[model samples]
Target: MTLARLAELHGVATAYEPSEGVTVQVPDATVVAVLGALDVDATTPEAVAAALGAARRATEDRLLPPTLVRWRDDGPVRPPEDLPPGTRLRVTTEEGEVVEGLDWQPLPLGVHRVEALAPDGRAGGSTLIVAPARVPRPERRVFGLLAQLYSVLSSRSWGMGDLGDLRELASWAGRTHGAGFVQVNPLHAAVPGAPTDPSPYRPSSRRFPDPVHLRIEDIPEYGFLAPEYRDARDAVLADAAELRERVLRKGALIDRDAVWDVKRRALELLQTVELGPGRRAEYRDFLAERGRALEDHATYCALAERHGHHWRSWPEELRDPRSATAVVRADDELTARVDFHCRLAWLTDRQLAAAAEAAREAGMAVGIVHDLAVGVHPDGSDAWARQDAFAAGMSVGAPPDAFNARGQDWGLPPWRPDALAASGYAPYRGLLRELLRHAGALRIDHVMGLFRLWWVPEGREPTEGTYVRYDSEAMLAVLALEAHRASALVIGEDLGTVEPGVRERLARRGVLGTSVLWFERDWSGTGRPLAPEEWRTDCVATATTHDLPSTAARLSGDHVALRHRLGLLTGDLGRERALDAAEVGDWLTYLERLGLLPEGPGDEEAEVRAVHRFLLRTPAAMVGVWLPDAVGDRRPQNLPGTWDQYPNWRLPVAGPEGQPMSLEELAASPRLHRLLSVFGSLAEHRAEPGTGAGAGSAAGSRTAPPDARPV
Candidate 1:
């Protein structure tokens, strides 16, 4: 009983409601391990009793909670009931300005400090979080392009797509195809080593953008490299050309390590060049703004280059960022390496800004919609540097459901909810701020994590995990404040196993939810395709996602064959193929009935256009056209269940015949032009004033059978 009480106090669940009204008790061993991560002991009955007593006593003794959150729109904060009658309170803003007394004016939205003084000379301190009431929402409906950055190779790229390619893609899509935004996969820094994981969803640091995406020639200093380095630069360039040719001509997989090897060497030479006075001052400003987080990340990168990538393997003193021994170990050579990494971050940030600028210049309203990965790699800089912020020895994973009975362990550590609250969610705030720096809108992957997360104990299967709750109100308030400050829209990927009212709550807060076309159905009624009018107004409507089959693959029944070939299908291959074909036939039949599909059975490109045209018939605030779908690519950028069985995230954008297509080739394709003409014709509906309510045409309002399940 005491153990359960301790777990409850810490927001650790003793049992979870996997489905509404269904509760499953968490195992005792799991509870003990979870509590232990919180620095609480529950290993034995005696320990449980002692810990519970300590927890109760700690709450009673506190003059204030570790953190206090109040919306700026709300009236001035009231003093805590636990404060002594005559106790005085003083608040300090992040800018160092201080205010005294409980009659505090609505504070600015940020992390502030609060100090309490009692008549008896007692004192206490806490963090105060001020947030906006709600985030900003789009004023009108818009459509955009969705793409995976690395796969969209251009003629000027160094084997893999870089920021230069992003800029060009955005500018062309916005100017020529009338796209309002270009959503890209997460560009978060990956763990540095050979044979790096190709998936961007799992990254080393969410706070820092990966320098591997940097456009080598964009740095002004690149042009000034000494004539002595010309031969070496030429050789690197030749190698890059060969790599690019292999991907574009020979259909070779993208080699991230090879791309980074060339970029890293070139950056090393560029780092030797001195910055002008103005640029130096700007760099200093960036350093000052980033502060400790930037310094620690740069130091970790330097240390990783010296030792290996993982910080746990580093010497004891070096594990802690602020340790005196670690500082001493950062010699001149190490210091130079640190500076190089920092410069890379600044350069990447600059190019990202340039891409955003290019999009806006080419008439894109939202520009780039950057993705935020759910968590950081456990062995990466964030987990090592901010040790206290995460739960030790626990991995974030999905709960067992109808989709995957075995569940999934992502190998990313869950944040310690208590720690985040105590720090006024400083780390989360910092991450959002950095991501929004160059984004017009930000898409949060697994936004459900803001409420609760399934935590698997170290060495345990994902099924042996329990849901841990977070302070969602506080989390949303911080997100709203951040988005409001940045003038950026927020999109939550609220799909699969979402709790009831979660969608409603996010909508109320003005955070748009994702509405994939395949998943938007009237489940309350017949299990058929949802009428276009029934689709929600606040969402990003898309035909497919990176994890699912491409539009062409779905239409042609190619995904089934691919999965079967990779041995990923659970049922008989023949049965799977028949079911897949029927699903495609159903969608095609409905598209034909609506006058969207002009051609019959085997015309894949025309069917693809019809699918997107159906999306246009919906009232969703934003419609996302998968860049691959535009050119009839038949491969998914990622296949979730397989690792090496298929090239996930490494495949270049391809044609209908499975041939790689360069950006130049795509831009010149008449088929792409014809398909986009459909979107261009529907531009009027997108340009309709105000929210997308009643903005859709009535021509496609007839309901189809609700086959809302995603493949």
Candidate 2:
């Protein structure tokens, strides 16, 4: 009971419902570990009792929480119960303006500093966050392509897709297919090393984009290099052509490390070419804008290059990013290396801006919709630079569910709730600001994390985990403010075992939710496929996601076979195949019955188009077409629960015949045109007012407006 009380005070869930009627009590050991992460000691009964007592005392004595959140929609400020009458308060707005007294008026939309003075002469302060009531929503129904950027290789790319390919994809899709956006995997910087983790979900830092995604020749320096360097640059380009051919012509996997090796060499030579005055000034401005965070990240990268990737293995004094000893250790040579990294960051940022600009120039209503990973790698830049912000020795994971009986640990460190509040969520706010700088929309992976997260202690199975609550009000307020400033839409990945009221709250905040077609059944009443009208309107509806099997793979029963071959199936292969086949048949039959499918079964391509036609039937404001689905790719970009057995994230985008297809081939493919025609038909309806056949018609043709004004 004492332990439960302590847990409650820390917002740790001592018990949770794994299923409808099953309540699983978190073990006492897990509770202790979770409390330890929060800097609360509760090892034994006596310790728990003492902790509870201390918590109660602290609450009684404090006049304000470390952080306070008030929504603009909530009206005015109400004084806390503990505040005595006539207590003086001074509020400092984010803009350096100050407000006096405890008036019942609304504060501006920003983080304010509030200092209170009690009648007894006691003084304390707190961070007050005032956020916009809701994020901006899409004005019209928009359709876009969702893709894994690295897999969408172009003929000019060096094995893996780069930002240059991204730019071309956006321009082509926007102009040719009338795509409103091009949504891709998180471009967040990966931890530096050979054979880097291919999954974009677990990044070293969410604040910076990865340099590996940079297109080497796209750099201004490359174009204006000295005549002497031309031969050397051409030689590198020749090697790159071979790498590109190896993936597209041959059956080789995308070698990211090999591609980066060549690009790095080219970059080293280009770095020697001094920048023009205007370009130099622009680079300086970028450095000033990024400030210390950029410096720390660049320093860490240089250090990683020098002393392996892991920071823990480095010398003791160099562990802290700001240590004077570390500064001394970083001699002139290391300083030059750090400057090189900073330059690379500046170049990458410029290219990303150019891509977004090109998308809008091509008439895209929503340009590049960037993805935000849920957490950072445990040993990466974010974890090292902001050590105080993350929960040390703890990992983020999911609880035990129907998918994996043992649950799953992602090996990513979660933010420490207490630390985040104390710092007024500076780290999180800064990250969101940078990401939204060039994004038309931001998709937050695992949006439930704002409310709470399932944290597993280090060295423990995922089952030995408990939920740790966060200040969702403050978190959402910050998110809303950032998106409002950017005039960008926000989508939350609200799938999986969501707690009650979470979806309702998110919808109220105007942050869009995610809706996958296969998962939108009427589980409450009939367990039948949800009719198009029954789908949620406030979501980005799609047939599949990156983690799931593609439409063709699901329809053709190849997914089950692939899983079986990789030993990822927990059940018998025959039974799994039967279940999979039945599910696909059910959907196909339903589509055929609804007149969406002309023919089904063996015509997998036709079935794929029907599945998308079904998506168009939904009233969702936004629709996402998986790019690979249009090409009839049978492989999942990423196969969850398998590592080396499957070349997850390595397979190039392929055609129905399992042959790798370049960007040019995909654009010209007859099959892609057929799939895109379905969207075009819906787009036609959306272009007309009062047609009522398209989701946009009901909204009075939000998308039929003139082409977006280019920035």
Candidate 3:
């Protein structure tokens, strides 16, 4: 392929200009492969001449430049042995000495600063940093939520669990259940509109929280509304009450958009009043600290509301985030709305911090463990605000695997690896610091992306996606440095088609891997579930995940039937049903063999408790109870790739009869007490073993099966 075609395929903008006379490094193998794939006969004399001419023209035109490409662990430290005549070698070590030598001794580990001065003294150099071998850290604790955050019900929640409900749940878990940490869904900011997207994984912005999570009554300014606005507020309250009643009494799925609509109307009124002096100052400081990024985000939201969510559909000027005309237009027309959105972000941040404080007050050891989604919406504030940092024409996705033969496009642009490195990974580090500010631990979705991601070119199927490598060493180094600074634990979602040695690398960095009970099998052998002793100690073990079915659903084969009914099953019904049955039967038989399952036809709740007890036996450091499992809510929160056809992320925590249970009622229920009692017994057993295991260890072991060994 021509250099122009190769650059286009890689999503490089046409306007890019290489530095003058720079010799860019192109992998010879890659170039030859590209040429062969394009059917260019490079071996022929005429073809060879044409190819050479094209290469020279491309290089001279600066369409392609010889850039140094370095891969982590490519080779041992060595100076360039084959420099051109009069080549000036300048080596700078960690000691900050610039020495001239063609052959220098290996620099000590850690970031060894190096600079190479070109022969002309018109220097072009880059840092040559050494990295320590990535090593796994000791596993930390992880406690699971029963359901999606907004889907959890409390008597006071407007038909769904809000931050208030989470605070209460965390308090109860820490004080009564002895949980070290509480893990919940992504809770990332969602696009604002009717019938809002329920899947938290596909969020508008991973950097911000969705205001929909805020409990209307919990706002400090809620009660201070004008009398004229009081009636509207009361109406909204009544609507919330009705919504809650629908879930609690009628067994209706929670409507996130409806809930948000009620809250948004009320919030608009609440915004009429300015923040109190202290809060206002804090808000100002936040804006000042965030600077132009905050302004751009706010402006994007404002423009989106006016011109539809997609920035591409906006007026020509507004389409470009950096356009001076767009800035002036937004300032003149949407200033108030932009400020309002900014205030919402500030309020959400305050509440998040408050929730952490509440956890600390409630005696929680790790406090809140927040989730980071894999990517942001392509048309959302984050994409518009940080357009320069992301790949414009490529989408992030997964390659075709056994499970998803067609692969999948996430429709979220990924950070350009080169751009991120050039920026010193500032955006990534900033996002992490914000999330970790109030988090005891952070769960990174699709942690494998730190190494490489499937980049699907525009207008191409997922099968055409290619792997774009990243600097995992630099990424993990930044992660470790930040985690150390924040004193927070890290859990990487390392399930599904992980590249070889990735988990081992993450483990070495003190980052925990995710192990779901169903998928944690010895794939190299008979594919049987991993024995507790065989389970990795540096990991979080769970029965299921948001993408999968609940324990009860999986065991009963309801998930299979649901998929079949929805026409999502690719295989014959009999085969799918049989596979599901056999998997569950194997687990049940294993549990019985381990003496964890009670004899006879056990109730679903009893079965779930048995599963937890089984998990408590595993050597894995962290165990997560899919929050829904706690209450026997046997539905998956999300089914991959389905939109509008299924009730994704709408189900509330319900009893067997499908009646939603409020947090107050759930907390007070005998069933809840029984569940907590089982957890308490497990905790007591671990403590008595003199393993120095506390809530953290027990929680970490929640991922293990019964009879599983201790980490």
Winning model by TM-score: 2
Task: Candidate 1: give the clashing pairs.
Answer: 527-706, 528-705, 528-706, 528-707, 529-705, 529-706
Worst-scoring 10-residue span by lDDT in model 3: 702-711
Which is better, 1 or 2, measured by TM-score?
2
TM per candidate: 0.94, 0.95, 0.81
Ranking by TM-score: 2, 1, 3
**Tens-digit lDDT string for candidate 3 (1-711):** 454444344333222112233323434343333333333334445665676677566544431112222223556556555444565666666477665665555554433434555455544454454443332233344344434787777888886788888888877766666665678888788876665567787787777788878877878888788888888888988999998899888878888888887877888999987678987888899999877766777777777777777777777878777782356554765877888888887878777777776666655556677889888888887887777778777788876655666777888888877667656566787777777777777889889888877666677776666666677877887676566656677888876656556776777667877777887666667878777777777777788887787777887788889898888988999999998888877777777777877753356677777777777777766677776677676677787757788887788877655667787767777776676566664343221111221123212222222111100
Write candidate 2's Cα lDDT for 290-367 as tens digits.
999998999889889988778988888778999823673459888888899899899999999988887777667777
Collision count of model 2: 0
Ranking by lDDT: 2, 1, 3
> How big is the positional error of residue 187 in model 1, measured in Å on the Cα after superposition?
0.7
Stretches of model 3 off by over 4 angstroms after superposition = 1-119, 124-146, 324-333, 598-603, 681-711
Determine which window of 10 residues in candidate 1 has minimal summed lDDT.
693-702
